[model samples]
Target: MTEQQRKDYFDKVDKNINEFGYHLTNVFESKERPSFFYSTGIYKSFNLPEIFIPSLPHGLCCEIADNYVKAFKDKRVVPRNEKLQHLSGRFPIFLIDVPTSRLTDYVLSSVWYYKDGNYEYVQVIYPDTQGHFPNDAGYDYDQEILGEFRL
Candidate 1:
């Protein structure tokens, strides 16, 4: 999808999230079930990355990544045995908005394997903390907003 199209799609999700609190973020383009789809929790100037995580309950960052790998291996969006599929492999990608925030302790991790299943590539996108949350709470300053996109 083009940049504009991606922005538009994320905008739609943002609107839905605002109205419904949370929504299922799915990738209908994939032939097999999606291993993982981008999700976000928006509060004020922050847009936190999240996972839909059918097999596991809602969790914080990297908390449900193991479930993501199991789904990828089984080629199923919803794993059959929830109890067994409990381990988070390293994610494939990480995108952080770097220009605005003071860069520090940037780390990238990965796990590689070629298996005939699903989800070949994992995409990680992290926003620049400074760009997203420009001013700290209780600081009167000009309002600034970050670009809207899925991780």
Candidate 2:
């Protein structure tokens, strides 16, 4: 993307986020990654719960992530799974809007999770063209890794 296009895209993203009562918490950028990742949080006046998930092994983390994405794509609350509840407790849901021609209102319900106490990443649940969440069909799917950063 050209510099102008990049600016325009982020301008829209910022406007949409503000319209939705959210503000950017942090932005992750890396020379190694192809895309930029924006972390957001609800405004203070919104009175939303803040949820944090402790670091877990890769396999269990992926499982909870799959379920989390499914719940958001289906427009339902995240399921009350024992493991998820134990790890994350209760937290508010955040949204990241993606500009796509296929779906104007496309967005990802997102949260933060730690991986083995060494890495932290954002997990977002979004729908594909088939209207199905990824990793639901027994396919070995990889969640979109927004970026990797050094602390």
Candidate 3:
């Protein structure tokens, strides 16, 4: 990213967070990793863990993230390891504590935005359309695609 692009990106992140109480950082898929999106400003505003959703389409990730943040804003805290049924229709979403080791890899932007603070965040993993998670008895997906976010 160019110097000007970097400036613009931070400015947009700050603006959105100020106006919407949170912002979504979407990372598109690359040859080495699947796509993922995460929320910034939630922890800042609500003392809630930032959210991360890996290995999903951009639009779906955004929708699920919006719901999660909105619920958090209203004080509906979803416990870690709980399945949030119907939060995304047939595909129930789940949350788990994001290992700090993977933050630099999967959530670099969030890390940068927070200035590498010891803030809390969670990985928002979910099941396939068939409702099977990456580790379920019948889950289906390659470890190469999910990397360290297959929970």
Candidate 4:
């Protein structure tokens, strides 16, 4: 995707977050990945898994979403649960559209765990073909964790 398209896509995502009453608390960007951390005013909001950080609820340090490199070799749509297996612990998960040049469309599901006072973010990229997570299909997935940092 062109630079303008990338900016436009993130703008839309920010707008959606505002519409939902959640606001971004921090943002991190690098050559290989970009991430957004968010929080809501509501009580008992989404939280990260305890295994990742036992002191906080999923919502307190929640990584609302992120984007990562698409590295699937097979090129097929993957089930949500299948993607979750690549994650370390249970927490709420949702898929979001991401801009990509490697595929026609990419859906990224994000979950977070707390580590070293920062959020260890995991994003499972579901491409139209050959998903980017470990699965029964036996495809080799080599991408590393996309982003991690404090909120």
Candidate 5:
């Protein structure tokens, strides 16, 4: 997408988030959820399997929606779109909220492409926070952090 188109897309997504709020419950309930699913051809052609994150219900959608809004507002759509295009339809998305301090020191590569004997899958992890919480086991810094306990 061109730079302007990317910005426009981000703006559109931000408007959606602002109108709907960055609530996962709402994101999931929205009629647009079906579009997020990959086409059978996409999987078959790319050998992309259903992706799964070991973590569950970690509010990754909220983070993504929130980031889109922030990117639009900050006028950072170009870089944002570049990163997003690489991620789009690449992972099924699995997330979990563990204390950052509790997370393992392991590299924890969140996005992976895997294929084995007629099986394939891509996984991606979106952290809710972008701040420095290296001590916490699995705190996402990309989230809005609405409150101490809320992202």
Candidate 6:
């Protein structure tokens, strides 16, 4: 993208963040990894850690994320490091702290927009069909397939 195009892209992102509490970005899957979507501006606006979900269908991810932002705006923040059924979805969400080292790989746009990496983040971890989390015994699938949790 040209410099002008890049400027316009960031401008749009800024507008979205200004209008809404956070901005949602969807990254399609590639050969190396599965698809993912994440939020930006949550920390700047609400002082709440940003969130992301991976491997689920893109549309579903967006729906859940939008709902999450909705709840967030409603002053219903998600609790971290525990099983949660607060968001609108069948799968309970577990918020795991996203290490600062991994921030560049996941939330680069957010960091760029804020011009800093001092903010905190939490990955919205989802469980398998049996409701078993990554750390649980008899967990059904690999954690990375959904999303990585680095605490």
The TM-score of predicted model 6 comes to 0.83
Candidate 2, run of 10 with poorest lDDT: 111-120
Off by over 4 Å in 3: 143-151
Higher-lDDT candidate among 2 and 5? 2
Per-residue lDDT tens digits for candidate 6, residues 1-151, read 8999888878888998899877888888899777788888887887777777777777777777776666665564656676668664677777777765675776667877878546767777788889887777878975563235532
The sequence of per-residue lDDT tens digits that candidate 4 reaches over residues 1-151 is: 7999867756654564456522334334457544333332111122321111112233533532211111111332322233343222333322222222221111121121111232222333332224423333554644322322111
Ranking by TM-score: 3, 6, 2, 1, 5, 4
For all candidates in order, the CA lDDT equals: 0.32, 0.33, 0.73, 0.30, 0.30, 0.73
| C-alpha TM-scores of all predictions | 0.26, 0.26, 0.85, 0.22, 0.23, 0.83
Off by over 4 Å in 4: 1-21, 30-34, 42-129, 134-151
lDDT of 1: 0.32
Query: What are the clashing pairs of model 4?
Result: 46-58, 46-59, 47-57, 47-58, 47-59, 48-58, 75-129, 75-130, 76-129, 76-130
Backbone steric clashes in candidate 3, count? 0
RMSD in Å for model 4: 15.2
In candidate 1, list every pair of residues with a backbone clash: 66-87, 66-88, 93-124, 95-124, 95-125, 95-126, 96-126, 97-127, 97-128
* Candidate 2 Cα RMSD (Å): 14.1
Give the Cα error of residue 33 in candidate 3, in Å. Answer: 1.1
Winning model by TM-score: 3
User: Per-residue lDDT tens digits of candidate 5, residues 1-151?
Assistant: 6999867755654453355432122212245222121111112332223222322243543344334334343442223101243232323222222332221221111111111323322223443334223234765444322112322
Relative to the unseen true structure, what is the C-alpha lDDT of residue 133 in candidate 1, on a scale of 0 to 100? 24
Kindly list the per-residue Cα lDDT of model 2 for residues 55-106, writing each as its tens digit: 2233443444334443443443333212233222232222222222211111
Residues 1-151 of candidate 1 have per-residue lDDT tens digits of 7999877766776676577543344333346332333333321112232233221223423344434433343442332212222343322222223221211111100011112221222233322324232223443323222222232
